[model samples]
Target: MIVFDLECRRGQHRFEGWFRSSEDFARQEELGLLTCPNCGSADIGKALMAPHVGRKGNQMPVHAPSVPPPAAAPAPTTLPAPAPAAVAAPAVSSTPLPPEAMALMHKLARMQAEALKSSRFVGSSFADDARAMHYGEREAETIHGQTTIEEARELLDEGIAVAPLPFPVVPPEQAN
Candidate 1:
């Protein structure tokens, strides 16, 4: 017996059919007796054959045919869901504002101006004036002026009630 790989011209479905010889396949095809089992197509022809297997004494041997590789893979059927709600929030700063916070500092300097209108401009004499007021050598009054951190520290060490203003005050001579 001989086997032929046959394909349907209409649906291109391929399968194998047994015959007495290669001539038998040709004779069946010429007689229009060949049909595709998959799509019932009668327009059939011999499919391309792979390398033949070993033969017997004046006879042919049959072997299981190889399967064709897939033309395309199937699409995925499912998708993942959204995550849970237990995520932690991020932390932010908790420190006090600096002495140079722009608009707020400008507003604070204006408030200091109003407060100092009834006070005095001691210029760089801030440490001396503050000490004199602390010792009762001068009348106690609101004052704003320039002083280094060292001067502020000395005044504070001497038990003066001096507090560093939140903004630098421009001297009257430096005003625009």
Candidate 2:
């Protein structure tokens, strides 16, 4: 399975679309079967994505040398931020983001924490609580917790509203 970052041309909204293969994605798009999940618009296209070329079974990854090359420029003062979890760690020179970008990331994390302040921590019960609320078996309220990706997908398939946070959230007890 492969996932592509898809964007709606009309709405400019981005979402992930999972497909069996690149050809599958192209076929769906050609048939107008690929619509923006956000706005339900048929005008959609694959967004620019970082290369995720698969490695051959016996191929090994190449690493960059620690010593600077003769043509290399002077090193910058700042260090690169750690790679996002989705990608493999780099083995070569990495250009770090500017201070403004780092500050924006911190601000975003703070905002997310504030938004989830009142949400209950359900831990392993996340799927159960969400399911209960969706079926009207229990009153709906704010909740945040951990559950497998499979469970989250199942919830969405069942038409239950559930979202994964952009940043990893620490449990309340862990925070305290």
Winning candidate number (TM-score):
2
Give per-residue lDDT, candidate 1, residue 88. 16
Off by over 4 Å in 1: 1-107
The true-versus-predicted C-alpha distance at residue 48 of model 1, in Å, is 65
> After TM-score superposition, what is the CA distance of residue 108 in candidate 2 from its true location, in Å?
1.4
TM-score of structure candidate 2: 0.46
Tens digits of per-residue lDDT, candidate 2, 1-176, equal 99888888998877777788899888888888876656778898888988688999899888887876566677678996642211112236488989998999999899888989888889989999999998999999999899999999999999988888879988878886
- Error at 55, model 1, angstroms: 86
Q: Which pairs in model 2 have colliding backbones?
A: none
Model 2 C-alpha RMSD to native: 14.7
List lDDT for all candidates, in order.
0.75, 0.81
